[model samples]
Target: MTSPTSRRTVLTAALAAAAGAGTVASAASASAAPTSPAGSSAAPGALVDNRFWHTYTDWRCGTGDGTRVLPGPRPGVVIAVPAGRTDYTDPHTGRTAAWDYATWTSSVHRSAVPATEVIASWNARTPTGTWIQVELSGVYGDGTATPWFVMGRWAAGDGDIRRTSVDGQGDPHSSVWTDTFSVDDPASGVRLVSYRLRLTLYRTPGSRLTPTVWRVGAMASDVPDRFTVPASTPAPARELPVPRYSQNVHIGQYPEYDNGGEAWCSPTSSQMIIEHWGRRPTAEDLAWVKPGLPDPQVCHAARQTYDYQYEGCGNWPFNAAYAATYRDLNAVVTRLGSLTDVERLIRAGIPVITSQSFLKEELTGAGYGTAGHLMTVIGFTPDGDVVANDPASPDNDAVRRFYRRREFENIWLRTKRYDAAGKVRSGTGGVCYVYWPTRTTPGQQRVLRSLGLL
Candidate 1:
């Protein structure tokens, strides 16, 4: 969980320049009201903003190298390039065998309204000895664009390859790396209008290593402070029997993946779902992981979904993408308006992964407070309380816990409140990671269609 204070610092800095120019106040006010369903008048807190995916363009390799598009993970194409030395010499080092790079840029996307923040995310698979890095920039009010900022350098399977200022990698073959960057102010007197992304692939010369990129996207929005309450009543509360998996039990199991259990909540909740669907990873999938662990698949999930920049496995989109790797599963990161929306998924037999934070007194049964945490909402209890598989518990057996309905809803849906620092910090705003059968049954399709997700 991210602390409210830290969130406030980032949000404040990002919106500061805009506020000074008196631009942010209007944008925020415009989006403060909610949007309504199609064919209906707008509701309170119903502002709608667009999020777009800008595909790669003008891909080219430096001298002595080549580039081509290859088949990528479902519906997406990958840019593949070979390892070779660049023709240009390094001015500082005066060396001829400098690292080579293949580059691609995304088309600029203009938002419907001025955006408060832009988040960039990507997925890639690289062989040993090769790596990928991403950079982002934005244009505000048709003025000069912000300088390109490095998102991160990533390689799968290698634990030492951290997302930092350091370039290149020692070895290859890691799982896909997905990370998000919140774009902040570039200059004063500029209202953000458009944004762009650049991806660079680097590898050792003659290493025969090729890296493949699956998908890259961005979400830009003026995150509202509140959401409209659903007009319909929630389904009667009833607890669903969900299996438990605790992060505490796995502590110290894999130091490479955020020192193991302490940070494994996201993957642990994901594992429970994978098992519920009867699609647990086979022995071969866990072969690379050291033996003797109770659920090696959880470890595999952690490694595959880990975000180098965030330095944790709790990224919402990354976790959803990881679950999609399994057959018969499709996942996405989205925000739900109310618990009724959650109940719809539950009735369809789909568990939801939600991000939330609360003070100890706010949520009973959970003894700690988190800046942010992920839990599986398996079902609701009779009387409309929450029945969740909370991986943050002390042990697997203790993972099942309940929370008062009103308290849980307030914490989950309306987390953007004043923090101890007297700054208004924003929460995820009811964000959820939902994984369902790629091929849904008629019943499932009905529920999804009702929610406008089908």
Candidate 2:
């Protein structure tokens, strides 16, 4: 095993070289395993059906719902890409297990530690061979963040895809070594998925480090065939100022209200995007919209005309909630349902505004506003600020504000239905809604700049 001190030395040297460059060296290759499909190294136990595919989180256990353990690898992990692949499967019922994407969360688990973090994944192609890809997105630690540090490794059968990978005999069942160290050796899907992932956060012997485990899968399989590789037509980049609009607004169960009785939660929010930001719908924007969602079975003619694309709480398609069970938040729920619809939107480079309605009514009553509503967050900010596109006032336009990070995340948690109660103890249903611009793509940025969203 490489000593902790040695690991820190390696990371520091790499980071020092990366300073000011805005880029980190990624693993040699990001290709999938290349074994001929299905020769069967060892079959995974059983693919169980799970419903959390819409949210994101760590430590997915393949039970009857979202995941199942295969026979060969006990407690192995699978990362699916190109968005619709199932990471785990049950041979019995053909049921696949998954986690919700919206709820997915990650942490190093070590307290006060700074070191390189590598996310490894194991994947298999049905029948014959399995392909696995691993990469390092960035180095995140106290007061430090970088989203561009990327590296990847891929091995196909006995032939290594990347020049940096170590050669394996049959299928990665141990006995592999790379240039870095013996531990960083590449292996096959059969062996990689067999063991629980270890949270390896490099730190000094006595530094306070928090341990973190990243959740990999989405509510559903929504990853693309290739990440790390730039899109063929890079979507234009436009930054919008998110708002804390309606943070004090209340919610009710009245039919008049849009988001679980909070009328302004979505429509009004959408209005802000158009009226203030000058974002209108384009042909592509209209392509993914879905109406009458976040409360399934309750369809409205108005929303269904456009594809709302977002499948998080109170979004569309999966928008069904009964007094009896959890809410459905998707227009199309093909597999494990936890991957949040917002994730898909962001990946597609669509700028969005999501709202969290407050439950103010009595628990026994049908409608009420418990907390604030109508806040917005854009793409993740390196500064940890809650990004927003507020239209309330010109001063607050398309700005990044450092709202109490913890508080802001907590509020979003409540809105996403991840929070059981308003204050964690006052348990009530929580839901979030997305407000997209009429236009899709950075072309919206062109329109916004012409209209001064700049």
Candidate 3:
């Protein structure tokens, strides 16, 4: 549980007032600045900052049976709830609501970065049988709007679609969900001139469960030079001594969490970091997991971070938020500038979970092509090569692998690709998950200060 900070207090008060009046509160509107060409080739810059636009002041809301906007988990956050029952004909079971939905739509705005991709994210608190689906549409240079694309539908717990909890009871739990969609393909002449988002909330009838939403926002990015200049001498091959954990070892262990280990990369990497910090889950916490698992804690993480709507556990922000749920720990998902930036975190004894995609021949040692995969960047060799606990390895003994610094950097930074038909496809670029304890150690503080992130 998180301690009450000033932001949390303000958000709680705002939500309570809104809930009492059964009305939505307005928030200030935000807009992106005009786009400017990035600087010299040697010094690329961020196209979009990692801040969220939470003030729904200008957003429009709609509901089939009335709706209420409540407060979210933190300040600048709000929840959209559907009100009244949709099943008015069934007098005997009038409480059984019909198919009701509450929606919020954002005003369209042009990007200042000539964005090729847009990432939508949200934090949701949902009861059993409740879920949310998000869609995005982009306005092209021709002033034509792209068709609504389903980013993802999200709910807590496992399973391919939205359903009640495993035990047939409503479990009030929350998790963060994010999806990155392609908007502008350099090959295509259509540049995204403006974009808008729509969020729909759904719940089952006879269930009073209401879904809550927070931090709904989007980030845009333009392609950067994949091969930026490396350090003059490769920062003295420094690698933090961390434990190696493998996801392959747990394959077929839990069917509910994507048939076990094959898709457990994100949670597995997160579990490794949590254990490295000496904050393993207690027996009581893992009590819900089935028995006979070698590491119940890992299974617990897999279950907690699993995304029902996405049918995968690799949601970027969800894994980071899962780490934050632990006492004295905090985490965030963001994009890093370069390998040198990653080194700063390693030097501070922090392990970073990074997303990457590669064909079998593209990356040495790893004989596979994954549209997306997560691994822990633990350290660097004396020659500046990367040393990572790659969970995609075939077995536990092969989990730790080394790669050429340039090769690893290329795969990590540049994830966009094209098909034979000349269509664009990609994952989130230069994305990473950073987890740190709330009470920072001296080493952690030094690294944070040097990076100007503290």
Candidate 4:
């Protein structure tokens, strides 16, 4: 959904339309910025950089109602299976194989009626007929009251909605009836709409584990461009000279593996920023929050009422508060979706640190590949140039440099995950931050301080 020209108009429309609406109102009134279930809705104090506020909406998923448009921005689902393997087994396969798989089934409804039921099955077969079964339980949402439809099979094969039924290993699978939903008029002040799709899977006997694969399609819209990673090349090294922020303070003072796991992008980026500041950072100093956190099992079984597993990364800003942390740093996580927002932050004097390579693709449409991998925005150049620190360049050597304003804006929105795909799908929103020590000492305090726990 596109942003309205004025917040006043949008707010008025939302409030008026929400009078009789139930779930729709909940989403439109979602926090303007990051928030926890228990936190107040008032604006945050130290979010110092607020330029990316609107990016959250731009990256919102599922026909704009939150189901997250699949193949639209991120992977729809992820499954892990345990099994025994030997030299002949391709253990690393992402697809389901004979040794094991999983099954999920669900019944969903729209406006309180059974809308549809579905079962998705996936698996990988070995030449020897040994195989694993993987299944998906899903509900289809056309953004109307009808719950999304799902089809399940006991055997591994394609499931079709048009067909009355597909063959399955004979087992009793229950049936659920759902309702039909429709939003016939947008002029009725209800342009945004949604539906439900709940799913789960059951296993068949004798298979070591279930190996399965399930493909999903929108009954009303096209499949999304979920897997595209944009590319961009940085400017030629000679023209833009990097600048120096703190000549005496070298980032090498800190290193990766100090905070979160280094394999993921957010943690790795956070580690780089802390090192650049010539200060050590701890997990306490920065909040590494993401959405849909703490798998169902972790949340249910955790000992504490406020379990970390239940809180997911989307709560980073809150974690910052919990950790008694100060200052958050990292690149524009949402790509082109937040350019105007970043501009606002840089103007706020927040000492934003990020990689120059990120904007490279934006400058040169999907043009990726460069060595100036990690850089930070130190200050604006003369005549309003965007000054940055390039640690990789020989001339810059972590020195600050400048680029044209026009070029910077163009590149900003182009490189983010949101910009790469225009928005985030449900259960896929992500956040990143760096934890730099307030002082140059290494201790648990640094980590706690960054996380705001201390």
Candidate 5:
């Protein structure tokens, strides 16, 4: 399996550069203290800083061209008037169609931490024939400017245009790998000092329907270079009753999506969380799958989240975007500081889907080495070992297993590692997807807030 290559591991050139990049921005508010939420015990701050713009004030402050803000509890931006109509050819379908479009560009956001990498995530409602594109342009620590990068072109469904991540986008200083913006080399110590996000809303010509974007933001981080991170103390042992689904079970399924289920760890893990939240694709959603498949939901998730450019289902933000497609659910791709942050989430009934790369010997009982792999961290054992719903299992039943805590954390949280060939490789550096309901309970909201997620 090529790339066992999760998001940033698919390419060889500068793949190791992925390790040094940092991730999240808080257009909302940065939690300078982990103790902001009463009773929280995480470290001073998560390694990442998140800045999400979902409030009415944030939209009003942006430079809008034919776009306006919708006010209320869940305010968003929508097309006030067509800035213009343009013809766009769907790369996947080769169908050229005219669309009415509008845009909003955010004010510059200086990173609380000089970030070596940044990942952008958004929550929006795009109806049929309406979609949105998110882009980022930043100034490097050296005061040099970066071009605006197309982070994603997305619609809730694939009928209009295939939701995708733009490839071959970068500069002398940095590059966009799948969905993450990474500095060319973190060793250079040249980081992104500030940045702005631009949102372009599109709709079929003559249609009043417009995409409403609820949130658009970036995560910026500068995890120190380390092959092994300091060990985190475990919280009270507890396990969330998360469902398990193995990607191995869907082998040879849909050849169109990344040559089938063999590379669908991202979506398979996403489906598990969707179901754990009491949400699942309807029979209509699974109708496209061949009848008699054991877990049609996983297959459905894979297709819905596929990125045509990457030719794989492992695009990090794409998976989070797909999970948010479910009713009332909200998802974002962000990095957690440590397992202690995860424990705080577990106490709040949240399960984290983490990205990491490891050798067969690095993680006990994994029995496999991957340049990159995704697994669901469901709970902790009494002794603080990990209980995970790993999608790489032989079967769904075997998806749940335990691994030594020290080994798991080192493998999952480290930014650098030695590959099976004894070559230097990049690790995910604690990258993860956190999903929850929009109308979260006060306690859940508190936990998310404490983590700088709200």
Candidate 6:
């Protein structure tokens, strides 16, 4: 049913809106330089830039049409008035209807590290019959502009519209592959120098319902192409008490969501961390799952994060958005510089979900190879090896694994690697999902701040 090498894997692989395409709105706000994901370091090796607009001022600076900035412990933007109405056809369901909509566009942001790839993420509360669309447009180093690419169409639940991502979007400079905005060829030296995000919220007509967006941002990077990455000695060895769920156990249970369980590494890992923070779907929420199934919440996660367009549950930002839907939890899609960064979070009692691709022999003890996969980094061994909850295992009992430090780091941090056939392919270059609670312990805050995650 799915292509073997389609951008969805060797085992696997990796939206939107508005009937009125003629509507346009823009505003003027101050611009700022992007900050490195690891910190303010200007090191040449600091190739990742993370810029998010979340504070009250961040919302105030946006050019908004019928949008209001909510200020408090957590500030966000909601539709105060409908800017206009447009009919959107749910591509998955083939249902077309009209809805009132408003938009908030961020001011232009210049990347501190000019990027060859970019991925956008957001945290929002979309009530029933409501949803939000996020888009990114940017300028190249040559000052040439790129078309606005839809990053995601999201909602907290599936009662209204099927959450999805857009495809076939690109310009001469770049193209959007699944959820990532990538330069057609990074070897040409052309890169996205800066960008802006646009959030369009929609709800049923004449209803006061609005989607409150708490955070919206993107991670832009220009990681060097290499078969390996620089190694680092581990720090403060500590293993987190993270739960594990094997994707293989449910292989044929819900084939409708990304060909069933075999391709659910992203959502599976997400559910593990979400519960690590003590949140889960209610019985009513799990009512849809048939009885006798172990960890139905994993099924719930698969459905909640399923992307109709991509036809897979591996969308990076969609997984992060799913985690944020829980109370008091905040999640972002970012790139870390090294395993030391992951070690810092582990010491703070936080486990991280990381994206990478590797051959079976490349990572000793991994029974299979994948073009794209996600694993939870729970802790480290005394020998500095990686302790992971690998969802690809045959059962929950087989989920915990200790991968050799040198071997795991190269597979997880490298931007390029050779497949089983020895053909070169792109790596995630340290892309990960970092989730934490709104109320964090002092130790958590201190470690998060040290890594620039706060």
Query: How many backbone collisions does model 1 have?
Result: 23
* Model 1 lDDT tens row, 1-454: 2312232233222212111110000111112212211221113343323332312221221111244555323333333554334442322234444345566555554555455544454556566655666555566564554545454555554432443321121111111112333323323333455655556666666555656654554545444546323343558765555678888877877776676765888888888887777787778778998878876777888887676545577766566656755665666565566788788888878888888766666677788776677888999887788889988887778888887667777778773654445556656667667777656788888875554343
After superposition, which runs of candidate 2 have C-alpha atoms over 4 Å from their true positions?
1-238, 241-262, 270-348, 352-374, 379-382, 390-402, 414-454
Error of 4 at 5 (Å): 37
For TM-score, the strongest prediction is 6
What is the overall TM-score of model 4 with all chains considered together? 0.28
- Sort by TM-score, best first: 6, 5, 1, 3, 4, 2
Instruction: State how far residue 132 of model 4 sits from its true place (Å).
Output: 26
lDDT of 3 by residue, 274-340 (tens): 8788788888878887787666777888877765544556666567646755655656566666788
Tens-digit lDDT string for candidate 5 (154-250)? 8878999999877677778888887888887889888887778878899988989999888888888888878998899988999999998988988
lDDT of 2 by residue, 1-454 (tens): 0001111112322122232121112221112212112112111331111111111222332112112222321222232111122232322235443311111112222211111112232222211122222222222212233222212122211121111221221111212111111112222111111111111111112323211211221111111111112112223333444333331122332222223323223333433333334333344434433443332111121132111111112221111110001111111111111113233443444334443332323222213333334433454444433445432222323223334333333333331322224333211111233323323467534432221111
CA-lDDT, candidates in order: 0.57, 0.24, 0.57, 0.24, 0.81, 0.82
Report how far residue 277 has shifted in candidate 5, in Å: 1.1
| Global local distance difference test of model 3 | 0.57
- Model 5 weakest lDDT span, ten residues long: 29-38
Each model's TM-score, in the order given? 0.68, 0.25, 0.64, 0.28, 0.90, 0.92
For candidate 4, give the lDDT. Answer: 0.24
Residue 142 in model 4: shift from native, Å? 1.4
Those runs of model 5 whose alpha carbons end farther than 4 Å from true positions after fitting are: 1-46
Lowest summed lDDT across 10 adjacent residues in model 3 is found at: 1-10
lDDT by residue (tens digit), candidate 6, 1-454: 1111456223121122221132335433222423222233224567887777877888888778889999999999999999988888888888888889999888787777899999999999999979998988788888777666778888888778888877666777677777888887898999988788889999999999999999888888888887788899877679999898998888887878865555888899999999999999999999999999988999999998888877788888999999999998889898898898899889888999998887879889988888888899999998899999999898999999999999989988998788777777878788899999988999998976655456
What is the Cα-based TM-score of model 1? 0.68
